[model samples]
Target chain A: MTALIDIKDVSHTFATDGGPLHVLDHLNISIEEGGFTAVVGPSGCGKSTLTRLVSGLMKPDEGEVWLHGERVKGPRSTVGMAFQNPVLLEWRTILDNVILPLEIVPNKLSRAERVDRAEFLLGLVGLTGFEDKKPSELSGGMRQRASLCRALVHKPEVLILDEPFGALDAFTREDLWQTMHKVKSEEPFTGLLITHDLRESIFLADQVVVMSGRPAHAQYIMDVPSTGERVIDDLYTPDSAERLNILRHQIQIAQGREPADVEAAQ
Target chain B: MSLKKIAIPTIAVIIFLLLWELLVWANGWPNFVMASPSDLGPAYVRYWDLFLINGWQTLWRTVAGLALAIVFGTALGMIMGFSKVMRDALYPLLVGFNAIPKATVVPIIALMFVGAHDFNTVLIAFMISFFPIAVSVSIGLSTLEPEYRDILRSLGASKMTIFWKIALPKTLPEFFGALKVAVTLAFIGTNLMEIVSPHGRGLGALFDSGRTNSDYPLMFAVLIALAFLGIVLYYVVVVLEKIFAGWAERQET
Candidate 1:
């Protein structure tokens, strides 16, 4: 099947104070129509550069990025993006913040329907009473949850989570993974997550694509074993543990910090 | 909101007033030489008409000049902040203009306007007091987080949309801060022009006369009136800050 999103033989260079920085070289990645794919890589591997390319915020110097069979040249309207920081507008109330996309992008829904959708999405994430609250009024995790609702409110064809849970506390992170899956099951959009955490990739992604160091490329690919519907308890299984372990070792080697590095440090 | 806010300043002013009264009394200085705090009342009654007319003139001039400054300053700031070329071209000019000693610039302004004293005064005020506000508003627009723009862009927001929804709303707190500062500078600009101009008719003129005649009560009285005007205008900006900038404050402060 033709992929919904495709990055084929893409290379990008950034000019910095030091010199030309070649961050991604001849990288290839693609996602099926409704797949949730996670990209895990070492720091400075140009993961964010990859995101910018896919989102059409920046064009790759070589090759091309195609979305739904069309080349992406500018910011795409049919995509939702969230970063590590919630990036909520402090001046706007929670409901206003969640519905901010609707305020900008052209929509066919009535104003009331827009508000209702925003309210319903907020409710889906257990934020029923925070409709009038400002982004600042919410806690960090709650703010991220609101951000998640915002990304989904317009019901885009794709959702990009660039380490969306990286900064949250461990418990909050774990809780949000469950929230992530729950939301995904209900709202089945293609998702692309860029993360450093191997377990997070294993838990949340249908397919995990790994990248090597700067001038990055797809170095490895792994699939989570088929489960009819994933639950929090399924994460406790030994098979999942094995997957996690192998993924960890793969990442360590790609990062050039293998068991030998650990032994030498010891 | 706290005893420190209201009580400390009041107590300090009272203490300063008492000390001034004691000094005048201790030296047995004449009212022309030095006036006691109590002398302000009768002296005010003596020049109440002059006070009202001149104070009104000064107050209105200050407001008019400041209002014009705000409009021009905000626009300039938004432009400079958004465009690197404009900023690079104008920033140095602005920095130089701001440094040129507005006190000296007033005479040249008076010369340019020739007979239009009021225009000259207002122009002086606008020129002197607009930098902080312009710099403030533009900085606010320019310094927005990269992610904020990216999120908006991903939603297919145009450059104008990002500006209207993000840049403008984000500048409120900084804009208000600049207004508060500009109000005080407005007073300075107006009064300085008034001081040097021969046809001085404002409290600044009264100050010039009091200085010439060494009329201590008259100088103190004009200062009191100017202080009242300054407080009122400053508070107007503060109230505006609360109304318009409350969201920004609640967001971060």
Candidate 2:
């Protein structure tokens, strides 16, 4: 079967006041249906830009993005997005905010059905009773949970998480990582996560793609050895440490702190 | 609002009136030159009928002009917000027009549509007031967080959908803030036309008549009436803002 998302040698350049700034250079990545992939790179390696490309929010200057073997010319309702800031509308109750995507996307579901859908997701995220509360009433973690439900409420084909848990504290972040696993098992969707935390990548994703510095491409791709269901304690295993070390070394090479030969010698 | 909030301003106004009465008494200024707060009381009772008729005229004209400003300003603002080309084209012209003293244009408007006093008064109010609303609304639209927009766009939302679902609500706080200011400007605009193009209507015309007869107490009474109307209108906006955009306000709880 064709990959659910196929980015074909995408290249992009942004015009700045100083002149043209190259961001992505001949980058290629693909995610199979129901697969989760995490992208980790330097601060400005155009990882966020990659999410925009897959979602079709913006077109790559050179390459074509294909979804289910079709070129993405513009944004698709099949794609759902979540960011670090949940950005729930203050005017809306948590339930209403979660239902926002359903309102925007074309749907046959009645209002009652829509509420049922959002309520289910919110329950999965442990936000059961806070549906009537405003966004400000919830803690940061709770708000992000509502944001995740909003993304999934429409049962999107692809869910783009642009550092969705980046702003949370360590404990909350880990809790969310497990919640992510639970959410995916309940609502299967192709997931593309853009993150900076290395531990987060191995914990949540079956595959991690390390990207090089600016004008980045996928420098190294690692298949996380599946050990059935994942838990936070699983990250402490000796096997998981070795994998983390390898990925860390690769990132050093990508960052130009260590020569590529240093890894080859080891 | 708390009772303390209302009581504080009320007490301050009473103190202010007492000081004014004391000043008039000490100075022993002629009644024709300066009227004390006590003098204003009798003047109000004497001209109570005239105040009702003229005050109603000014009140309606101000409300009508502000209503027009809100409609026209919101449309213009949405256009400027959505299109960069239109914003660039219209902004400079709007700024220039707004800069022209509205008082100077009152007579020109009066001359252009001779005897259309009500229209001229309403137009001046709209002209003076709409700029802030348009400018505030455009600012609100332009500064929208890109992440919120991207969330919608990825869902294949149209521009209109994004505007209604996201942009319009986000712009409410700014819109209401601009409305508060524009209401005051609308009052000033109506009064300007009434005073300059006096056509036997509004408190402004009454004030002018008091000046002609050298009835200082009557002039002060009219001034007090204008201030009262402005306050009532301003509080109406504040109450409406509380009802509509209450979420924008920071809650103590």
Candidate 3:
């Protein structure tokens, strides 16, 4: 079966004041339709750059990015994005903020239909009564939830989450992990998450890809063993611990603290 | 609005007026040398007609000039905000023009317009006021968060879409702030033109008339009227700011 998203030998560089800064080096990734992939690595590993390329915000210098078998030349309307800052419009209420994308992307939905759609997602995220509240009125975690609804409101073919929950507290982050599962089970859009948390990657994603430090490429790919339904307790199980251990050791190799051949020798 | 908000400023003004009256009484200054707050009441009643006519003229001139400034400043600001090349080219010229003393420019404008009294007043007001609006708007737009634009761009939003949805709304608080400052500058501009070219119109011309006749009470009354006008216009902007960009004032709980 063909993949819904494909990145082929992609390489990119930035022209900085100090000559060129190479960011991505011959990176390759592919996600099947409805797949959830989490990318984790050392800080500044070009993970965010990868999201930009996949979402068609920027073009790859050396290779092609294919979405649903179509070459992405510019920004695509079928990709949704969320960031660490949430970035909700201060002038708009929660409902209106979620309805923003519909106003931009061409659609046959009526105004009433758009509101209904946004309202449905807001309800799913447990923000039913906050329809009229301004972004400032919501808590940080609640704002992030509203941001998630906005990304999915457009019903995009792919969702790119660039550390959407990175700013939340530990408990809030865990709660959002559950919310993610709920959102996925119902909405079923292809998701690409970039995170610094290893446990977060293993818990939420079906597949976790570890990337090398800057001038990064895909260094390790681990397929999470299928469990019926994931819960917070699943993170503490022996199976989960073993997988986390391996992933952590791979990250050490990626960060250059451990020799590359150590894992191979084992 | 709260009573405290209103009462506090009113009390301050009354105390200020009383202090001025006490100073005049203590120094035994003549009316020509200094008119006390008590003296202002008679002067106001005596030249009430002049105050009405000239004050109306100044108010309209300030408003008209400010409306024009809003139009021209927003256009110029959008250009500077959107295009880096335009910002680089036009910003220096704008700064240079704004740097010149508006008082000196008033006589030059009078010379250029020669008998076009109303137009000169309005033009001066627009010239002095437009700079703040343009500078504030450009600063607001240029400093906008990139992540906001990226959110829309990734969804295939056009430049125009991004501007209407993101740029315009985000710049409103700053725009209103500039407008508050611009309104005061506009009053100064209108008065400058009126005084420089004494065309028998506006509060500044009225003040000039009182000066020539040695009517110190009339002069002080006109100054008070001008202050009252400035205060009223400033509050009008504050109200509009509340209506439009009230979200910026939201408190974190």
Candidate 4:
């Protein structure tokens, strides 16, 4: 498969009162077309920064980020993003929030067509009847689902998720993972998800990229078997546990803790 | 359904007014010194047409000044909010202008446009009402969520598109809030102008004439008219606010 996104030796640093703080250090990554990739790391490991760079919200201090053979200079409309916080506009109803991108992109579709598209996306996310409710009226999981609908409404080539389900409970998070998987199956697109949840990464991704601590660079790339269906039972298998252990170990080592000791503590 | 809530305030006002009328009548005060409600009622009815005519003049000036202020102040405020360079350049000047009491400049305005005929009064009204709107709008636009800004940026929205779609809509509530205050200031400013330069007939001119000739009843009538006009204009803004900002209000509640 051809690369949909290419990050070549990208590094980022921010100036601080004490000194320069390095975030990403010469990170090289490439995402294949129609692939689902998850990036996992401990907190402050620059995982979110990686998504921001791919989405063209921030430029790498050194090196290049290319999307579909073009250098990423600024925000790219072809990319859609959802955050951990859901970030829905409070004043807008769920339907309006889902259709927000279309409102900004005038003449993209007729008014009737836009409404149909918004309804279709809302239905896909199981938010059909809650369309007219404001964000404040919805649960955290529902809000994030609405946000997901919003991100997909524009039908962008690449979807960037920055821990979109991090704020939800375990049951809700599992349910949304399946919902996301179902949505992915219906509308296949290149996805880059930055998350700390190893099970989420293993279950949803075609490939999982692990990163080291701050001044983070790609540390390991693990390919998840293309199993057609994943259930909670699959998580009990020795292979699944091994994969999870590897990721857990990598995170511990990156955070300056001895992996053996961390594992013992756990 | 909530008759008790409504009745308590109504009863209090009636009792207060009755006591005032009794006190004025019992003391045998001069009519010019303090006109009772009974005395003022007939006076108000007799001069209702004149009061309305003057009230209309004041109302027109206040509304016109407010409209002009909304246009200029909202635009300037949005610019200041969106651009640091604009804020740095224009903010201090705005502060300096605001620092000078608008009332103190009425004489200067009158002297400058003595024969200009109603021009100075409208200008003074605009000056006084404009600042609050500009300040409120700037604050509102500047305080938008970073996430929303990010969304716009990622969508490749142009600066003008961002302003019109995001900034302008977000500032509507604050703009209306400032407008509520500006309406009252517009009334005060227009009245001040009329007092300083009484060319055309307005509430302020009526007030000045009544005070000069000791027409206490007429003075009371103008005050009543001013109160009614101010209340009416304020409610108009409130209604518009409810219509325009219904979505935001729903979110708040």
Candidate 5:
């Protein structure tokens, strides 16, 4: 499969009061077309920074990032992004928020087309009747769902999720993971997820990349078994627990912690 | 709950007006010195036609000035909001200009636009009203949520697209708020110009003439008429805000 994204020996640093701080060091990775990949690490491990680099929000200090064979210079419409916070526009209704991306795209669709697209996406997210509600009127999970619909409305090639579900409660996070899985099953696209949830990474990702603590570097890359028939119930199985355990151990090593302690905590 | 809210304010206004009327009656002041509410009422009825004409002229001048201020102020504000270079270069100058007492410049304004009384009144009104709009709009545009801008940028939205879709809409609530104040200021500015210049038929001209000749009843009538006009114009802007910013206001509450 062709690589849709290529990060070639990239490094990034920031000038701080203490001194020059290295965030990512000589990172090299490539995401294949239509693959669902997750980057996991400890807090401050620059996982989110990597997502910013790939999405062209920030530039690397060294090397290059190529998207669809072009150098990643600045933000591009071909990528959709969602942050940990839902960040829905408070002044807009749920439907209007979903239609925001369409407003920004060049030669935007007509009002009728835009409304049709918004309604379809809102329905897809189970918010069909709540279209007129404002962001403040919705619960946290519903707000996040609306945000997800907004991100996908423009149909970008790559979806960059920087802990999009991190702020949700456990149940909501799990529910959204399933919702995401179902969405991907129907309309698959390349995704880059930066998350700290070990089980979440193992559950949804086709491959999981572990990173070392800040001055982050890729420490391990493990392929997840693609159980095409696996459903949400499979997450509670012993086999799934074992895979999660192994991934947790890899993360512990990356963070310079004892793997045994991490296993015990789990 | 709604009844109590309305009842309280209505009762307060009635009591206040009654006290004023009683004070004038008890003092037995001459109508020339202080016209009671009864005297003012009859005077208003007698001069209603003339008041309406002058009132309409003042209202038109206020609206024209306010509309021009909105157009120019919104454009300048958007430019200042998005461009750091423009902000740095122009913001201090804007602040300085805003600080000068607009009333003090009435003579200069009249002199500059000699032979055009209505135009001078409009010029003064525009000067008074434009500053708040520019300041409020710039602040609103500058304070957009970072995530919203990020969403637009990630979508490869062009500068114009982002300005119209994100920046402009974000400033509507603030613009309307500033507009409310701007309309009131425009009314005051027009009245002040008429007071100083005293050329055409206007509430201010009527006021100047009444005060000069000790036509206390006419002056009192015009004052009431001006107050009514101000209240009506203010509520008009409020109604517009309720219509355009309905979604945003709901979010706040």
Candidate 6:
């Protein structure tokens, strides 16, 4: 069966004053419909580049991106994205910000239905009372929560999130993880996460793909030990810790920081 | 807090005026050479009618010229902002116009366009003020955050949609900010035109007449009038910004 988003042998080069900088080389990823996948790499690796490529926000120089088995020629409305910074337009109130995607993307839904969906999604993220407040009035976590609602309000088939919780504190990040996961399971959209947090990957994704440094390609993929259902606490187990260690070891090797990391850990 | 915002400026102005009066009195200059603060009150009372008429005329002409510039300038700015070809073609021309001293062009406009007093003044004001507005708007549109734009495009928004929803609203605060500078430029443009050309009752001519008549107090009065006009115009821009672009004031994430 065709995956919801398929990236085939994609490579990208950014022209700089120095020369052409290769960011991704022969990168391939397939996200099955309704499955959550996480991509982890070093800080400067091309994980975010892959996120943009799959969302159809950009073109890969060497390969094509496919959505539902069709080649993506330009940006696609079937994908929704959130970033580390919520990027809510300050002028817009929370409710208006969440309604932004629906306003931009054409749909047969009436304005009332759109508002209803925005409100419903906002409520889902536990931001119901603060809808009337401006983005400036909210905390960072609340702003990110509002951004998540904005992304999901349109009900896109695929969701691309680039380190959306990386800026938050540990507790806020974990809280949002619970909120996001609960919302995703209920809505059942394919999710792609670009992050470096190992425990975050373990708790949230069905599959965690490790990546190399610049000119990034997937180094390894690990199926989460607990596949059926997960709560944040489930990641505290010894087995989950072992899985985290394995993923961490692969990432360190891919990043070329600690080749003997595994043996060193013992 | 708001009271403090008002009181501090008011106190500063009073201190400045008092210091100026003391400096002039201590210098012991003759009244013909300069007017003291005491002389200003009588001078204003004597010339109140002239100031009112000329101030009204300047006000109308400034508004007319500024309105024309706003319409054409906004369209021009958007076109240049969206198209690199348009920006490149117009950039040199705008630079050349800016490089020329507007004062040099004022007399030529007066000599070539004889008898259309309104037209000459309006053109002068338009010429001086439009550059800042157009350039600011173009820059604002051109420099929009790429990440926000990606979000819009990923939603399949059209270029026109991107412009209205993102570019235009984002540019408004900058555009409004430019208007504050543009209003002062409009006053300067009007003064330049009125000095050389036939501005029937502008403050520029009134000040020139005071100079010719050796009426120092009258000159001071007209300067005061012009200063007041500047303050009023500046505040008008401020209030408009509050209504239209207030959201930009907050620095939240």
lDDT of 6 by residue, A43-113 (tens): 87888888878887778899888888899887878889999988888888899999999887878888789
Which tens-of-lDDT digit does each residue in A1-266 have in candidate 1? 67999999998899999999998989999998888899998899999988888888899999999999999999878899999999998888999899999988898988899999999889888899999998878888999999999999989899999999999998899889988888988888898999988878888888999998788888888988646357677778898898887777777877888767866887
| lDDT, ranked from best to worst | 3, 2, 1, 4, 6, 5
Cα displacement (angstroms), candidate 5, residue A215, comes to 3.2
Per-residue lDDT of candidate 3, residues B97-169 (tens digit) = 9999999998898899899999999999999999989988888889999999999998888899899899998
lDDT per residue (tens digit) for residues B47-68 in model 5:
7888989999999998999989
Weakest lDDT window of 10 consecutive positions for candidate 1 chain A: A225-234
Candidate 5 chain B lowest-lDDT run of ten: B244-253
Candidate with more favorable, higher lDDT: 1 or 6: 1
Question: How well docked is model 6, in DockQ terms?
Answer: 0.76
Considering every candidate listed, which one attains the maximal TM-score? Answer: 3
Structure candidate 1, residue pairs in collision: none
Per-residue alpha-carbon lDDT of model 4 for A1-266, expressed as tens digits?
A: 78999999999998999899899998988889988899998798888778888888889999999999999999878888899988787778899888889877545598789889999988988999998998889999999999999898888999999999999999999999989888887877799999989999998898999898889899888998878657777878999999998888887788889977876887
Candidate 3 residue-wise lDDT at A133: 96
Could you tell me how far off, in angstroms, the CA of residue A219 lies in candidate 4 after the best superposition? 3.0
Candidate 6 contains a number of clashing pairs equal to: 0
Question: Taking the true A–B contacts (Cα pairs closer than 8 Å), what share appears in each candidate?
Answer: 0.91, 0.95, 0.91, 0.63, 0.79, 0.81
lDDT of 4 by residue, B162-240 (tens): 7776777788899999999999999888998888768757989988888898889888778777877888899899889
List candidate 5 segments past 4 Å from native.
A14-22, A42-45, A89-93, A102-120, A132-136, A229-266, B1-15, B26-34, B251-253
lDDT score at residue A173, model 3, on the 0-100 scale: 98
lDDT of 3 by residue, A49-135 (tens): 999999888998999999999999999889999999999999899999999999888899999999999999999989999999999
Which portions of model 2 miss their true places by more than 4 Å?
A: A259-266, B1-6
lDDT of 2 by residue, A126-181 (tens): 99999999998889999999999999999889999999999999999999999999
Residue B1 miss distance in model 3 (angstroms): 6.5
Model 1 TM-score, 2 decimals: 0.95
